[model samples]
Target: MIHEHEWQQWQQQSANHAATAAFLLLDVQTNLTMLETLQAALDKIRANPAAEPYSLSGNSYFIQLQPHRVLIEELYGDDYAEPVTLSLDDFGDALAYWHTQI
Candidate 1:
């Protein structure tokens, strides 16, 4: 469940990049659990490199999980845009940074 403190932390988090902005704007109910879900997807890919990629909608963005990496695409209502690639390790680092900031 989402906590007020967490939401407050998010409010103080940076949105300096497009990908970060997308993550920040995700719908709290269905998409705020992205870190866990993305980590799980990273594990799945690591377990089987041949595993098919999967795409999950984060209400306002789409995360496409591939082997060792993810593609983040911001969405506007029904429209989708180009995806930005991010290694799972890099995403972990980003999370770590956010944690430190909070």
Candidate 2:
């Protein structure tokens, strides 16, 4: 359930040849602040799957918090279409690692 993805390198910059986006996976890591926020959001969703699906907005990402997963319609450097189902335990593992990272 740790979703794996490959980024498409567009040699030709053209919208006509654009590819459908892939949804966000739980393992990506970067800015510490954002990572913490995402982890918190994940915790909330897992704690109360019944309270969703709601939205979390920021300068770059816009996530749809579902029962057990998040839909990243506008991740800064990613493209997403169908929602990616997640394995919470794996995601938590990533988050744990993220703590020791930036």
Which candidate wins on TM-score?
1
Candidate closest to the true structure, highest lDDT: 1
Write candidate 2's Cα lDDT for 1-102 as tens digits: 112231233212332112112212233435577667767877887898787575656554455657865454444555554333334554455455545544
**Measured by TM-score, how close is model 1 to the native structure?**
0.57
Colliding residue pairs in candidate 1: none
Look at candidate 1 and tell me the lDDT of residue 100: 42
TM-score of 2: 0.47
Error of 1 at 97 (Å): 5.5
Q: Write the per-residue lDDT of candidate 1 for residues 1-102, one digit (tens) a residue.
A: 234456455434433244753574453233435556655776788789799997777667777778778777776655555667776665555454444434
